[model samples]
Target: MTHRPLPRPLNFAAVFLAAALTVELLDELVDGATGAAWPLVRQDLSLSYVELGLLLGLPGILVNLVEPFLGLLADLGYRRALILGGGVLFAASLALFAVAGGFWPLLAALVLFYPASGAFVSLTQAALMDAEPARREQNMASWALAGSVGNVVGPLLIGLAVTLGLGWRAVFALLAVSTVVALIGVRKSPSLSQEAPTGEKLDWRDAARGVVAALRRGEVRASLALLECANLTGDVFRSFVALYFVDAVGATPAAAGLAVAVLTGVGLVGDVLVLPLLERVPGVRYLRASAWVTAIVFPAFLLIPHLGAKLALLGLLGMLNSGWYAVLQARLYASLPERSGTVMALGSVAGMVSGAVLLGLGAIAQHFGVEAALWLLLAGPLALLVGLPRRASLGSR
Candidate 1:
């Protein structure tokens, strides 16, 4: 007997991954730079860390708020337009960032940039998942690998930019160019074909009812809750690790950036190595194990005083945590296969929790110290434990 092939197999995975990879690189590239170069940006503008926290956190507020509407669009099967349009908007915002000279101006630029960036990222992944519903885990593993590349390259870019006096704004120009190229590839790709209608058009009355219903589902609540918890640690690590290295570890700005590179760069190994290793294992199992390992390892990472030891431990941390993104995301996408955008929007909402936590951490650091705040990141993995094997399987509802 002959077996049938996948429906025309758009085979857009390569183009989709390429476009997603470029944006992933740009996102982390700019963000990593922002974290490392904040001292300079803050000093030049005479802003406080509290203000820095606000700057980092507030723009994301609007982004998260808009995510559901964008999800509505995603459910409408407009992934192509969202992907390309969001990218151009983000690049434009980056250009504005290059010229902004003050706090309010920088804030305005980021308002446009962050939400656009969110669309570029979350929607693109939705589109990718749409393209290969069956191979989502593998595709997402590849996607995570690309993001891991950005994680490493982002800090290194910041380090090189600072060391060479190219300035943080200079990196934005390069990213803007890259974003356009990614869009070009997206325009040519076949990844955004509509498979089916996910939900009705966004009528607030209807949407409110639908959202309440989705939130009530066991799979939705468990998966999203655990994910939000896991990301709490992630938010801290992403936003503050470099600063911790600089302020607490007493490393130079450049060295701190390199240290962050070590943390994220080694994650490449995790994404790559875990793909095949966990192929037979369920996504839920991998996620719970990763959460446990991260919780166990973090305190040791903090207590160690030697820079070399911390870096080595960070490498280990990166490896273990690397597969978590893909695996967790696959679980979420599988849980609600049709509502890709809506589910993703809910995930983006989960990320808004970070802004609040980050603000609180900033306050804690301001009063107590940055080191004290870094300790708060352990909440991420500990959260994973609470939701752990009360764990949501795809069919766990």
Candidate 2:
């Protein structure tokens, strides 16, 4: 029998993915600009490193804490409403940050902002998975590339704002506008509920059961652990890389901006290439090899002596690190076919926990030195390589 491909209109998935990326980019811009504002904020508000970590890491924690509930909501045919509400809340949070002048207000705003961002990310992934069937790998690659593009644009946009003599408050205003645009795009998106399974009310108990089920399966547990480790390492690097360049490597903020641009730009290339390569290599082999390579190449940052060399090394690291999320996400989505929404939500929880731990490590590094912290970061990939599943299948349960 001849099979016909599913109807996918006007690349709606791509458009939806792009809108999601814009929100992510705006969030990143806020994150980068706030991090840059730390020196000024520290002197003015008497902020300590612990407080800084709290401001930066708290959003992620809140997001992780709420992800499971949000995912379950999406599975119960509430995907569109959840995304719309999340977008509105995210924009409102950014707007609040625009005028928030002191420490407490900013911290409170982040608690709201992070969960909103988490809802957008988790729901968007679920929507894309629901939208595409046969081209899952390709669609996952596209989704990842959208995020990589956001990462590249976020720091660059912040650098431009800094160059224009815009205050940090102005950056938050700009992010608010971006979120509003994303909200509009999301509203125009087709309802994912049309494609979802019917008559199945998600059980609240399944959220806990999903966690227990994932842990009991060795392959699923291994993949989740690897993601947590990699995410922790990446978050720590992101948090400290700009500071390290300025204080340790003797570069200005603009120069640090350029290095970040290069790092994330190369990562975009890695993300774009993964889908095509997936056709040639099995998922497990590709993941195992990528993990090994990243482990070997990531620590090479310590060997580079000059600013240019360090920037180049960061770009190389970006290429290896960028594809990790897509590969891992594809695997997880495949592993829990009937419950992808739940599984993805749990992954977000893991990322949140890992981010909190990494933020603490980042604070320690800030007080001591980045070089001293590199040793601990090196352990992440090594642990992944050791714990990685040996199975060869892409989505084998």
Candidate 3:
């Protein structure tokens, strides 16, 4: 009898990719759980929409001051250190969120969480893009896929906690534990310690100069603008959907949670399909067409009266916007080339505008109600339709 073939050894590159992707998965899991739990958090803290706005927007504004610096440091070959340190803070912030008794405490936790996530999660993403320079779009699609899966799971976890009578706090506490495991995986990734592309031990001042230079590029500026505008349909939309279901659709808390899951679950399917689709079509071409369709679909989602009809439209909206982030983000990395960390820095700068938009949306929701505030989300598709290049030649498929 012939001997059996030997088992394959571990591929370090694949292992590193998995570890990096896990960080993104956990980050989105936290976001999904938070969005799904907003109603419960609101009731427990007795927070007004304005306070909710502050919680979401102010921390982001504050984090911008820190994240740009962190991004610079990452470009200077400090990525592994920054990621590891940020992971510790990320875990602590989740622990704080679990025990927060009121709005101020919750705000404090989120304030800490934002910059921590920028360092822990965003830097890791940059490292992944840097690892596979030629495959930036494809890798970004994979990243989005991992995040979409997290989005689906996060709401289900909230539902499970509520069903078990453990509550939203329990969900965050569990997330804290899971984050530690992800940190361990990242710590073991050998690829993370590589030097910057220049291979020089540069100072922060040099990194700062690099960021300044990156900002001067028109393509970089356009990408950053598109990213912020596109976000109106993403986390910004997610933050309000469950609340909208509760207030406007008159769904029960359980059903509202289900609404969040359904939206994200369909999005996960879209993310999956977009991976292969990106190889066949220029991402920008796909984006322009999707934007036009989303413009129509979003209004119908709001005007539709029946819950079933709204959910169907929500699923359609999710599918239509599938590769939005991955494509735009990949374009940003392409613009910057090997300077992925600089891309993170520029993105953080752009995120300030998004923070302001969230604050404005909150104020609008407080006065006119969530239904009116939701109309602001139409800006996402509109921005893409206006901003995406008319010809696909700007980026080869």
Which number leads on TM-score? Answer: 3
Candidate 3, 200-289: lDDT as tens digits: 777888888888987888888898889888888877998899999999889888888778777778888999999889888888889998
Provide the clash count, candidate 3: 0
lDDT of 2 by residue, 8-99 (tens): 55466557656655655565566556655666556667888898878876766566768777777766667778778888888888888778
- Model 1 scores a C-alpha lDDT of 0.74
RMSD of each: 4.3, 4.6, 3.9
RMSD of 2: 4.6
Superposition TM-score, candidate 2 onto the true structure:
0.79
Q: RMSD in angstroms, candidate 3? A: 3.9
lDDT per residue for candidate 1 within 41-146, as digits (tens), equals 7887898878887888688777778888777666666767887788899888888777778888889889999878767877878877777777677778888777
- lDDT at residue 43 of model 2 (Cα atoms): 69
Name every residue pair that clashes in candidate 2: none
Off by over 4 Å in 3: 1-10, 36-58, 96-108, 165-170, 242-259, 302-307, 363-376, 391-396
What ordering of candidates by TM-score runs from best to worst? 3, 1, 2
Candidate rank order under lDDT: 3, 1, 2
After superposition, candidate 1 runs with Cα above 4 Å error: 1-10, 37-54, 101-105, 158-167, 193-205, 238-259, 302-308, 361-379, 390-392, 395-397
The better candidate by TM-score, 1 or 3, is 3
lDDT per model, in order?
A: 0.74, 0.69, 0.86
Candidate closest to the true structure, highest lDDT: 3
